[model samples]
Target: MALRHFFLILLVVSIWAFNNIAIKWGLLDLPPLMLTTLRFVVVALILVPFTRVNLHQLRYLAVLAFTFGFMHFSLMFISLNNTDAGTAAVIVQLGTPIAMLLAMVILKEKLRLVQLLGIAISLSGVVVLSGSPTIPNWWVLVLMLLSAFGWAISNMIVKKSPPISPLTMTGWLSFLAIPIVGCASWLTESDQITLLVNASWRGWFAILFSAIGSSIVAYSLWYSLLKHYNVNLIMPYSLLTPVLAVIMGVLVLGDSMNGFKVTGSLLVILGTAIAVINLRNLRMHAKLARFRYAGRSKGH
Candidate 1:
């Protein structure tokens, strides 16, 4: 990748990393469901205007909206209410493995031996992370895990659905999600009117950051990169997001990371790297390592 493209990836990763902290900040002032609902509402207003949807695929789109937009994000924000941002970010990475496994079953997609191992390693890391003593509540992790599963399911749905532009699907997802999530928040959450009326600037900033920065800006940039580069080249960089989130959580939220958290994070990241990072790159790196070793041996 060129230096500029590298920086662009870094920029998007940083924006997404900081998004975790923003969600935590927003949860302090706004109810989790309410905050999530408003985010979709804002995104819907902005992007729905430009998106074209096929009326014939409304059912699939609705399913995508429910699973991806409503269940995934709603559960995520609720999970973040008690869990630290860093932990939530790391745990959510499991969604990749989860999706792979679901594909194996639901879509009859075959998993290579390495892919199966990757899934095992990722799940083991989730176990280790959840077992850590630093976590205030276990249920928070459960909710986050469910959120990951919802995300996985949504991806599977998309895979089975008709071809549609990602941007258009996202706009429709947010547009559809607004009512589903908004009504749920209104029904379950109390004093939402008061919460909205009295919400501080920080809370609003968090919503805008999630909707604009993470969803619109980051996703748009990501699609642009995918357009130019091979997906394998582009995707491996995204693994940095959780690592960056962990660092941001420590610095901004003062969340403590003990040995277990560190170890689990390493396992999760390594396993995901194995799963998603192109095997071609692995072979190239291996060849380079051999060449370097031979040079050192010759010098000796």
Candidate 2:
């Protein structure tokens, strides 16, 4: 990777990391569901104009919108209401292993033994993190888990869907999410009108940053990188997101970090790195060895 792209990846992850804090800040003034609704409203306003989808794509996009936009963001924001941003960031990493498992079942993808071990380690870390005293309620952890599952489901949907630009998918997803999430907010949340009317600059800033900085800018740059480089080369950099989130949560939000949290975070990060990073390297190396062996056999 060039030095500029490396910096771009850093910038993207940094935006994503700060997004956790932004969500927490938004939740201070706006109701969780309401905050989610407003964020997507902004996203839709900005990106929907550029989106075009055929009738055949509508169903898949709807499912993607529901799973990724509604279920994932709704549950995530609600979970963040009860849990620390850093903890939420770490817990959502479960989506990765969950997506792997889903691929095995739905797409018939095979997992190497190392990947299985990584999943186990990551799960154990979640168990450890759940036992932390800082957790206000265990149910929030369940919500987070469900949120991760939603994200995994969305990933599968994306894999199965027809070729579409990331920005187009995101734009339609956000536009479609408006009604689903907005209705939920209307039905469940009180004081929405008053809250929106009285929301401070921090609340508005949070929504704008999440919609533009995190979703639009970060994902655009990220997809651009993925287009130029192999996925294996790009994915490992994402592991830094939660780590940065944890640091920012501590320093910026003053979120408490104890031994369990620290240990559990390390395990999750390490396991994710092993699952994604090491496995890719192993596959690449194995392929190279096979090619070299074939070359030597031909030479003889």
Candidate 3:
């Protein structure tokens, strides 16, 4: 990847890291489902005007809607409502391993020994973090994991789909999700009118931030990167999300930061780096070994 693209990836990671805080901020006045509904509504209204969708790929788009729109955002916002932003962010990195597994099964992709080790290490870190005493509830982590799974599955679907502009798909996806999430909000939550009417600037700011910054800008850039690079290469950058989230969560939300959580976060980052990096070098090592063997055979 070019240096500029790497920096852009970092920018996207930063946006997503803060997005957890935005979700939490919005949830103060809006119900989780309602917050999600408003978010997609904003996303659709802003970007849908510029996007053109193909009716032929409605099935793929629908699948993306379910995975990203209904499953990922709904569970994620709800999880953020219930959990610490940093913890939710860290737990969501489980999606990396989940995506790797899905790719192995669906795409017949192979993992290096280092990659497998990294997955194991990162997963262990998650387990350690969740088991720590600071977490308010175990079920919240489970919800976050489900959200991660949804995200992973959605990524695979995007990879398999025919080339479509990321912004176009995102806009159409927001349009599709509005009704499903809106209905869910109405069915599950009360005081929607009361809260939305009474929501303050902070709440409204959170909504706008999530809709425009995270959904529209960050996700569009993310999908564009996915189109250009291998998923494994792109996915590892997500490890940074948790680190940034932890910092923001501590500063903004006053989330507890202890030694155990710190250690766990480090383990996750280290493991992810192990799993995703040095693939080119690994292949080069294999080639060098083969060359040495060929030279020896000729000498014999």
Q: Could you list the CA RMSD of all candidates, in the order they appear?
A: 4.6, 4.5, 6.3
Model 1 poorest 10 in a row by lDDT: 280-289
Candidate 2 matches the true fold with a TM-score of: 0.93
Query: Taking the tens digit of each residue's C-alpha lDDT, what string does model 2 give over 1-300?
Result: 468999999999999999999999998999999999999999989988877899878889999889999879999999999989889999898889889999999999998999888888998899899888756788998999999999999999999899888888888999999999999999999999899889898899889999999999999999999998778878889999999999999999999989989988888888877777765566786698699889989999
Winning candidate number (TM-score): 2
What TM-score fits each model?
Answer: 0.92, 0.93, 0.86
Worst 10 residues of 2 by lDDT: 277-286
Question: Which sections of candidate 3 miss by over 4 Å?
Answer: 1-7, 221-236, 279-300
Model 3: what TM-score? 0.86
lDDT scores for all predictions?
Answer: 0.87, 0.90, 0.85
Runs in model 2 with CA error above 4 Å? 279-300
Ranking by TM-score: 2, 1, 3
Which is superior by TM-score, 1 or 2?
2
Model 3 lDDT tens row, 1-300: 568899999999999999988888888888999999998899889988987777766678888888989889999899888878988888777777788888989999998888899988988888778866556788887888899899899989989887778787888888898888899988999989899999988689888999999978898899888888766567767778989999999999899888768877777777767776667865665687699889989999
lDDT of 2: 0.90
* Model 1, global lDDT: 0.87
Model 1 RMSD in Å is 4.6
